[model samples]
Target: MIPLLFALATTVAGPATPVDPTIARFDRCAALAKADPAKAAAEADAWRLGGGGLPARMCLGLAYAAQERFGPAAVAFEQAAREAEIQRDGRAATLWVQAGNAALADGDAGKARGFLDRALALPVLSSAQRGEAFLDHARAQVAVGYLDAARTDIDQALALVPRDPMAWLLSATLARRQSEGPRAAKDIAEAARLAPDEAAIAYEEGNVASLLGKPEEARAAWARAAGRDADSPAGRAAAMALAGKADAPPAP
Candidate 1:
């Protein structure tokens, strides 16, 4: 699930402004973003034109993200981050992370790396937030083939949030990339334990099983993933594996 940045209680950094009643409207738009992205985006756009400011643009960005229009969402979020910076708001780091996440989703690793670098340079992030930032930055690094740097970032993330399934999954994936079979198997096992129902975890377990020379275990794990959600990428990959196609690397 996407982090709810707007709902945080951190004090805004600029001169105090009276709470705008329109904030409720933007919140409503955001609340409906996934369920009705087109409507939410339209509402947010209209509000932005009427001088709704940062929150309105953020709502629009979320709406676009819900529709998987990640490139446009990154643009909106980057704009909001710049605006927040000019106002000296503490929300700048969160906005930068959102932009980075959108860019990553859009498969623009360079932009994601730049935005995440900005977020990490900010001093306002809480411990948990910093962990997430590191994990995301690591994802960007992995995309750009910086495996060593990704390992360092993910190590920091795991230090901060040891039980995070995503972080474990990423760790396992990176271990696999580095040809650390024992570590990959161990980490993927932890990820699977943490998120038993996650198709991606099952798929990764299969990968680790294959690497460990347990073909039967790999087939079983892959079959489990394929049965769980046939339309998902993990499911498709599992199916491909079952069809004698060469196994590919698991997605993060």
Candidate 2:
């Protein structure tokens, strides 16, 4: 998965074109938002009220997202997207994608799906951005139980950004969920190769091993996951999985 920093900074640069005033200001505000979200949000909101336009609103959304106030962030980003759309600005696509990601973070899968669908319909996104949009769309689909659709979108994401370990991880997870043990094992192996230190990937690798009835491999993978970061969610899960297996009764 894209870290919060990458997710927020994605709106900062792209398009090969020279940076304009709006983008400059957006960049400045995004930096401040990461450092001081409450202050940034206040300033951005005041700027919006003073007719600072797209950049201000985008900054407000950035500040909210930095604070993990994802519901408000989604609202702010969607409003900015609408503003950009009316003016025929290409940034509208990125804004919509940001809104979708925020909504997904807010646990509103249906709303996130709607926003992502809008983002994908726009023509201005770069190929990489389109791949990320597809990846997030798959997350939305997964949240809403649209597994088949999520699978298709993940496949598209993999095609576009095969180097992205997160995409491979998600594909492996979906394959495991669908009970395709060999495919899950293969995908997770690729993910591990790309991101050997990621606790999440190690934990998933353990899961794939377990699914394939390779308890020794599962135990080793889970041990590696816990060793990487015992405090992270995946690490904790891996530790628990190892514990449960250790306590299981022996077969007759």
Candidate 3:
């Protein structure tokens, strides 16, 4: 779940403008996360040399997060949020989202909620921003055991961006948590439809199938997911589940 926060941050883009060195470094770090986190951290360190602006600080926060340094990540994100506030840019909403995620990763649901609330208060955010905020809020709600609130937020996010694979994945996650197997399956299926190349959706579908007692279906879905992104958490979970049932074999 904490990793999902990282995923959310990776998907969001900042405003288009002259390349702010901090944001350029942040983008580079984001790109490196898929290939080489060590390189990403090095880039973030370089960005830090220019000395802590909102984007640079946020990149540092994410770099720490990628390294599983949650405490420092949260602190960096908090500082970034303060800086963004001082700058009073609407884009600061994105920083708030990142800070909320860092807080969530650190197991501070109260802090997560506070940061998410600030993100939601941003005036006239674009649909993408609103969707991201709702997604982060949904994740925070889930952390706090507010199942109903999580459902509402995720649903709203999906409505705002029906084609977003991550939104559907979040919906599937919420449904699974509620023990609504059919709904989870539906959400995962939609995610697969929207993002045919995304292995995560296939892995989610596998989980839904397994939960619904369709072991053969789960096996097939997991296999497809594994073929797409062998390193993703979804792929790992599917592989682990399959491995546990290796002796018994998948049901026909």
Q: Score candidate 1 by TM-score against the native.
A: 0.89
Best by TM-score: 1
**Candidate 1: stretches off by over 4 Å:** 1-5, 8-19
Candidate 3 residue pairs that clash = none
182 Cα displacement, candidate 2 (Å): 1.5
Question: Tens digits of per-residue lDDT for model 2 on 1-252?
Answer: 233342223343667856666667777788899899999999999999999887788889989999999999999989999998998987788889999999998999999999989999999888888888999999899888888899999999989899999889999998888889988889989999999899989988888888889989989999998999999988888888898944221110
TM-score of each: 0.89, 0.88, 0.71
Model 2 lDDT, residue 222, Cα:
90
**What TM-score does model 2 achieve against the real structure?**
0.88
Error of 3 at 97 (Å): 1.0
Please state the error at residue 170 of candidate 3 in Å: 1.5
Q: Give the TM-score of candidate 3.
A: 0.71
Backbone clashes in model 1: 0
What overall lDDT goes with each candidate model? 0.86, 0.85, 0.72
Model 2: which residue pairs collide? Answer: none
Where is the poorest 10-residue window by lDDT in model 1? 1-10
**In candidate 2, how many Å is residue 50 off?**
1.9
Worst 10 residues of 2 by lDDT: 1-10
